[model samples]
Target: MADKPMLDDTEDVALDFGAEDELDRQRRFRHPVAVFFHLAFRVASILVYLLCGWFVDSFITSFVLIVILLSMDFWTVKNISGRLLVGLRWWNYVDEDGKSNWVYESRKGKLKGLTTAAESRIFWLSLVVCQVIWLVFFFGTLFTLKFKWFMVVIVGSLLNGANLYGYIRCKMGSRKKMTGVATNFLGAQVWRSMLATATASAAGKE
Candidate 1:
């Protein structure tokens, strides 16, 4: 018999299927424009709220500017950024019965591929942090006796808080949907298996 060659146990071997690279790319910010605007509006609102008093002489001008920025941020995040970056959207409507309802929607099936982990992190982190910042501003305004800025802080809090709450509900709704789907699938599979077993036992008895 021929002598067998010795194997090199010290060599490092790795299996690269390119899957990791693809996942890493998917986790990056694929939509630069969307990411830019997503951060831009929120940062602008915060900056205007904080520094407007120093630049603008009139309180009315500062208030109006902050409100405008807040409104713009709210609209952009609620309508545009949320949908584009996180594949989530939410809106409220009044029905014919004089009842209010909030609708939360997430991209399903193939549409979910449009979202990235980086974008989602940016969207949610900014949303939550902005709310906390506004809350701090709220208390600071109250304690400092800056009643004029209190209204501005309130507006900021409401607008940012609404988005935070809406997104939280949207996330919870998505989880519930997924859970229901999995439960239904498992139930169906169990029923099918039981039916198969029953049919097999009946055939054997015959």
Candidate 2:
């Protein structure tokens, strides 16, 4: 009798099909909030780098210390669960209504896949590379005193502008395809966005 085809009456339909799973995944996604936070932090980081450039008393020591702190914080996020920072625009997927959503990536990825740790490592590596550049610039300024911190400021400004434009556009129902913009800067994955949208919408109102 095919084992009587027994049904588990206690389980909610949504729970059975994994709506909770998708929500859990979406919670990990990154969005504009993450970008804003990074932008703010990077500004402070750049200032520290420039300060390092201006003063030579403890250049290397300061740089190393800062790097260590930043790396540790990033690694914590990379390893921890539920406490990861899911920024506004860092790792986002698009919804059908075309709104952008975010996740914490590596830590979040672990919930869904086998290579979560590897992905987290990669994410951390990228962050480390950026932080290293940050420290080097500061250290250089301290030793040489001839560095142009303005350039860093300008580039950061431009990146922030682009980020703002892209994030706002995505939110506003802009019919314009966000291909070149999000792709080049935000690591935008349209397919993932579509999947996120479908899943989110289907799970809603049901």
Q: How much is the lDDT of residue 127 in candidate 1?
A: 91
| Local accuracy of candidate 1 as per-residue lDDT tens digits, 1-206 | 99999997796879786888769867788788988988887899899877876888999888888889889889989988999998889998999999999899878898897888888999999998999999999999889998978889999999999999898888789688899999999999999999999999999999
lDDT of 2: 0.46
Estimate the TM-score of every prediction.
Answer: 0.74, 0.26
Q: Among these predicted structures, which one has the highest lDDT?
A: 1
lDDT of 2 by residue, 1-206 (tens): 46787786785544455766655644453433443444345445555655765665665565564454444433333333112332112235799999987542222245334223333343335455554564465466567764544344334334434433333443343333456566655555766788899999999958
> What is the alpha-carbon RMSD of candidate 2 to the true structure?
19.4
Where does candidate 1 have its weakest 10-residue lDDT segment? Answer: 21-30
